[model samples]
Target: MPKVLVQFAHPAFSRSRVHRVLLKNCKQLEGVTVNDLYEQYPDLYIDVKREQELLLSHDILVLQHPFYWYSGPAIIKQWLDLVLEYNWAYGPKGYALLGKKMINAITCGSGHHAYTSEGHHQFPVSQFLLPFRQTALLCRMDYMPPFIVYGTHRMQQDAIEEEGLVYADILSGLASGRIRPEHYGGLEIINSLGHGAMS
Candidate 1:
């Protein structure tokens, strides 16, 4: 089984109902590790060597965070800046993360339509994630399509639960080698994991 590490980063985790549910479900799985970035580094003092060692040990890396300003929070950017160094994650002699798999688990308050071409954002959310995608490429990791939970602000209890279940199943599937390679894309709720359109 793949050792999946979820790098969870939420500034106001106590106030997040949606992400709380998402994290709760995924945390129960056997081989999945939920590393709360905020709880670990409240002051954003990231341990680059420690983070690098965690990456080296895990087969799958999940970056779970709230979509702040159409991107990740400051801590995630800081983590990437300090942990994913030039000589360790890339460069001529570096390829320690070559075969690992990565994906972002983002929770957004906006509706799906709001991130389209004719919508307020005027483009797809995937289009805005090129830096992340290309960064994975630079490190030679298999960057899977992001796992998104949209419309979090208006979702009811049942809707939130359903999304949480799907999130759990996706992590479970990835760890157990059940989710296929072709299924990895900018998938909303991992529709490829056989849970129907939970988006």
Candidate 2:
């Protein structure tokens, strides 16, 4: 089984409905390390060496957070800026993260249709995630399609729990090698695999 690391970031976790459930599911699984950035670095100070070490030890990296302003929370950007160093993560001598796999696990308050070109956001969620893809590419990591939970604002408790199960199953699949990164080609989101598309 591949070791998985979940870099979770949420500025206001106490008031979060979707992320709390997702975090609970992730915590229950084995071989999945949930690194709560806000919880760990309340001061917003990231430990570069420790973060790099965590990356080096894990085979798959999952950036799990809420879709805030069409991007990740502040801590995620802070983590990326501080942990992914030039000489270690992406420069000539930066082969530390090469061949690793990465994916985003995000929740959007709006419905999936809102991300379409004709909708309110006026662009697909993928378009807003280009920077993440590019970062993975620069670090020589295989970037998989994101795992998204849309319409979170209107989701009831049962629906949220169902999504949590799906999230847990996805993590389990990734850890057990049942879900291959290459199988995600041409897919817009990793959630498709949960809908009987993985086979």
Candidate 3:
């Protein structure tokens, strides 16, 4: 089984309705390591060497968080800035992450329709995630589609649990390599439809 490192970032997990459950399910899964960024770096002082070491130990990396302001939380950006060094994750002699798998798992406040061109957001969710995709590409990593939970505000308890199960399944599949890279036209498309596979 592939070792998975989930870099979770959430400022208010206790008050969260969706992210908390999603993260909980991920923890229950085997071969998955949940790295709570906020918990580890409450002072915003991320240990660059430690983070890099964790990344090197995992075959797959999962950026699990809520979609805040059309992107990840500020800590995730900080992590990118500090941990993914030029000589390690990119540039010449920076092949530590090459050939590894990367994926995002997010919770959105709006429904699927809200992220469409005709919807309030005026662009697909994929458009908002291009930066993440490009980041993985720059590091020579395969970026898979995200496991998402839409309509978070309107989601009921049972619904959240169901999505949690799906999230767990996604983690399980990815860790076992059952969910191959680019298996669902990238994370944006896979998330747009709950079920993912080759058609």
Candidate 4:
């Protein structure tokens, strides 16, 4: 089984509807570690050594956050900048994350159609996530397609709960090795597999 670490960042968690349930579901799993960034570092002070150690210990890294302004919240960038140092995460001697896997689990306010070229964003959500992919590549990690919950702005409570269940299923699959990294190849989004498909 893979040791999965979820770096969960939500600036306004109190106001969150989708991530709240998702977090709760992930917590119930056996081998998943949920690291709430804002909750851990409210003052924005990150422990680089500890973060690196966590990365070294985990097999899979999951970046879970709401898609803010086509990217993640400020803390996500801060964590990356402070924790992923030269000669540690990248460069010649930066092999701490080599062979590890990364996946973005993001919640979007708009529906999937809104991220298409003909829609409001005028680009796919995958395009906006290129930086994350490059970062994973630089660290020699396998960057998997993202798991997304679309149209959260108008999602009903039952629908959000269902998405939470799906999120749990995906995490469980990844941790248990039932869902391999190659399963995400050539895929735009993880949720397109639908609930229970990965398992």
lDDT of 1 by residue, 16-135 (tens): 999999999999987899999989999999988889999998999999999999899999999999999987899987888999988988988888898887888887788877788898
Q: Compose the digit string of candidate 4's lDDT tens values, residues 1-199.
A: 8999999999999999999999999998978999999999999999888899999889999999999999999999999999989999898875789999999999999998999889999899899999999999999999998998889999999999999988899899888888875776788887877788576
lDDT: the better of candidates 1 and 3: 1
Clashes of each: 1, 0, 2, 0
lDDT, candidates in the order shown: 0.86, 0.91, 0.84, 0.92
Candidate whose lDDT is highest: 4
The alpha-carbon RMSD values of the candidates against the true structure, listed in the order shown, are 2.4, 1.5, 2.5, 1.0
Residues 117-172 of candidate 2 have per-residue lDDT tens digits of 88999999999999999999999999998999999999999999988888898887
lDDT at 137, model 1: 89
lDDT of 3 by residue, 107-138 (tens): 88999899888899988777898899899999
Clashes of 2: 0
Better of 1 and 4 by TM-score: 4
Candidate 2, residue 102: Cα displacement in angstroms equals 0.8
Model 1, residue 168: distance off in Å is 0.3
Error of 2 at 172 (Å): 0.6
**Model 4 misplaced stretches (Cα beyond 4 Å):** none
